[model samples]
Target: MNAQYKSCIEAVYRCIEACNVCYHACLKEEHMSNMSKCIELDRECAEICTLALHSMQRSSTFAIQILSLCAEICDACGTECKSHNHQHCQDCAQACFRCAEECRKLIS
Candidate 1:
């Protein structure tokens, strides 16, 4: 609930929304085969972000490690999304990057 957590929580929530949007967008793409991995990672990243947010909210002792995992998942999702040329993918990648950075800050 501190200001230090505000940025990370906001970034995580934003990433969750972005990942959901990107996952749906990938599903609708005609190049479904190419987007399969991206969609999977998007779901995973969103789930991790949610877990990290809840852990932080509860001020859990394991929050730092959870955030670290969140950061790794965000990085992976961002990389996967960025491989595609779609605007949604690009936006999602950016959101993931922001979330990763914020999460790392909390850990450090």
Candidate 2:
């Protein structure tokens, strides 16, 4: 793959890993009862990131569309994560924002 494509794939993979970590971390929080929305978004974002990674890695014909949706999800996830005060959530939000930017680049 070209360097640019490789970089995008790497970004997607990193986002996937970050989302997975954040999801598990959120699940373990004692205040889980109040974090239902975050938990749900985390899981959904993780799944979308994984799918986006795979689609980009394979250079699927629909990769652009997938990445677009991933970008949207990442944006939403980042916004949601940033609303929390937890360190993990903050980190995840940053990662998600970065991922969204990377995905947007791919779109253009």
Candidate 3:
């Protein structure tokens, strides 16, 4: 794969990993109620990121479309995660933002 594609894929992978980790960590938090939004967004972001990764891997005609949605979800997830104080949430926010930026590059 080309450098650009490789880099974007790596970003997506990192976002997916971060989202998953954050989701589980949030679930285990003492006050899970407060992390409801973060948990929901993490699940959605991870699912969309997986789709984006697969679409890019196959060079699908809808890859850009899928990535557009992925970017949107990543932005939302990042925003939600950024509001939290947990280390996992902060890490997830960074990854989600990075993934959104990478996805935007291809779409633009």
TM-scores for candidates 1 onward, in order: 0.96, 0.92, 0.97
Report how far off residue 87 is in candidate 1 (Å): 1.0
The digit string of per-residue lDDT tens for model 2 on 1-108 reads: 445677777777777777788888889999988777878888888898888887867778898899899999999999999998988888889888999999999899
Q: Model 2, poorest ten-residue lDDT window?
A: 1-10
Candidate 1 vs candidate 3: the lDDT winner is: 3
Runs in model 1 lying further than 4 Å from the true structure:
none
Best model number under lDDT: 3
Off by more than 4 A, model 3: 1-3
lDDT of 1 at 4: 73
lDDT of 3 by residue, 19-92 (tens): 99999999999999999999999999999999999988888889899999999999999999999999999999
Number of backbone-clashing residue pairs for each candidate, in the order shown: 0, 0, 0
User: How much is 30 displaced in model 2, in angstroms?
Assistant: 1.4
